[model samples]
Target: MWVNLGVILLQFLSGSIMYSYIIARILKVDLSKIRDGNPGASNLWRAVGWKYGILALFLDYLKGALPLAIFVSLGIVKDNFVISLAALSGVLGHAFSPILRFKGGKAVAVSFGAWSVLTKWEAPMLLGTIFTIFTIIKPKGTTVQEDAFRVILGYLFLLPYIIYKSFHGDFHLLIFYDGNFAVILYKHYKDLWGYLRGQS
Candidate 1:
């Protein structure tokens, strides 16, 4: 139990590093004053440039991937509950990083990395395909918020597919995916609400 706790704490710390914020600081760009006021790679791209943005994205992905990979490789927490907890800690930390005063990225990239490890890339590939199709269909000049909403909608569409695939077994995986979807929706509640209200 203590080992599980330590693993979770370590994963959270890794996620809380706020790679975008660090990159923005080094580039002398205040992410808070940038697009959507998000201290994330997307905002960093808008604030500074794509180079820094890509770097931040990679770092965020690593934060999620590395710790979980290490824990699994070390056989620290073999049970599904503890393993899921470790994965969730990274995402929660990224979404609500302590270094950024408990405000952080949307966890899109970080979640991708973590889920890739957990699901052996099946989930990410499916989601990425959906996201790509949506991106292609999105009207030009769409606002960032709108694009994000479209992505979430895509994920919503994925739920049925996930359920269909797991009909034979793996009920725990359904719960895991649902929990992730819930976290994402909750994190983007403000944006989603504003979009619904036609308030930019």
Candidate 2:
């Protein structure tokens, strides 16, 4: 139990670093003043160029992936619940970073990292495929708002698969799923609310 708690705490702190935000600041780009006001790779791409954007994206992704990968693979955290919490910690860290004054990015990239390490890359692929389809379909309702809705929708779709695999009745996966979904929904709530209002 103590080990799990430690892993959870470490993962949360790890997730909270906000590497992309740091990268943007180092480049003298104020993400808040940019389009969509997102302190993430997307805005970095717009403010700088693809090289920096991709670099920021990779670092943001690594923060989540590397830690969980080390902890899980090394058998440092074997409990299913701990594993789930540890994975979600990375996502939550990026979503609610303390260093960023608790105002963090939406955590799309970090979510991929968490899922990638947690499910041995399965969940990430599923989520990525959904993202690809959404990209191809080119959904409407403004870019950020539409993307937020897509994320919420994509996770809803991913739930069934997680359920399908977790038929053992262990709720670890569900815990991570629910928590991650809540963060994503919460982070994008503004855009989501605007989208809903517009539709109405």
Each model's Cα RMSD: 2.0, 2.2
- Cα lDDT of model 2 by residue, 86-161, tens digit: 8888888888788888788999988888887778778888888888898888855337777777788789889998
In angstroms, how far off is 104's CA in candidate 2?
Answer: 0.7
Candidate 1 overall lDDT versus native: 0.79
Model 1: weakest 10-residue lDDT segment is 139-148
Name the 10 consecutive residues with the lowest summed lDDT in model 2.
139-148
Query: Compared with the true structure, what per-residue lDDT tens digits does model 1 show for residues 65-159?
Result: 77878878887678766767777788888988999888778888888877766777787888888778766777454566675676687678768
- RMSD to the native, candidate 1? 2.0
How does residue 87 of candidate 1 score in lDDT?
78
* Model 2 TM-score, 2 decimals: 0.91
Clashing pairs in 1: none
